[model samples]
Target: MNWLLVIVGAMVGAPLRYLTDRTVQSRHDSLFPWGTFTVNMAGCLVLGLLTGAAAAGAASSHLQLLLGTGLCGALTTYSTFSYETLRLAKEGAGRYAVANVAGSVAVGLAAAFAGAWLAG
Candidate 1:
């Protein structure tokens, strides 16, 4: 049952993530990976909210698996982020690569913290 919920959540999250990335990337023509960054930060915020809900006993274990593990797991892509950054650096966009890394980490963290605080 938990696995099914996870699958269902992933089904929604994965496509939504792709769609979001496409929409966001379509707006920008820069070397910076705005799509990937947006999805990752959004994913962090969602997961943080879920965590806070769980901490407050507002979420059940199944909900956690569905949203946190399944949705967020498929929604966020560390591998893609890493690969994009590497590709940027290899393609002579070293500054953009560094900026992506630094900005993603810093902003992602802040978003997560904010989400948790707001939710809690």
Candidate 2:
């Protein structure tokens, strides 16, 4: 049952991530990997909201499993983000690569905080 949730969540989240990445990449002309940044920030927000809801006893364990373990695990993809950052660095876009890393971290944190506050 839990595994099913993870699989379903991954199915939804992965495509959403891909679409978001493609959309951002299409709009931006830079090699800064804005797609990764967007996804990570969005993922952080979702995770924070889930945490707040769980902490407030507004959600059940199964709901946590679905949202936190399944949805969040699927939504927050560190591997793709890392790969893109490295690719940018390897292509000699040092500043953009660094920005990708730093910006994602900073924005992700801020989004998470915002989501938690909103949910609370």
Best by TM-score: 1
**Clash count, one per candidate:** 0, 0
The regions of model 2 sitting more than 4 angstroms off are none
lDDT of 2 by residue, 1-120 (tens): 878877777777778888888998899998787777887888899988877887788877777777777767776789988998899889998888888888888988888888888888
Model 1 steric clash pairs? none
Off by over 4 Å in 1: none
What TM-score against the true fold does each predicted structure earn?
0.97, 0.91
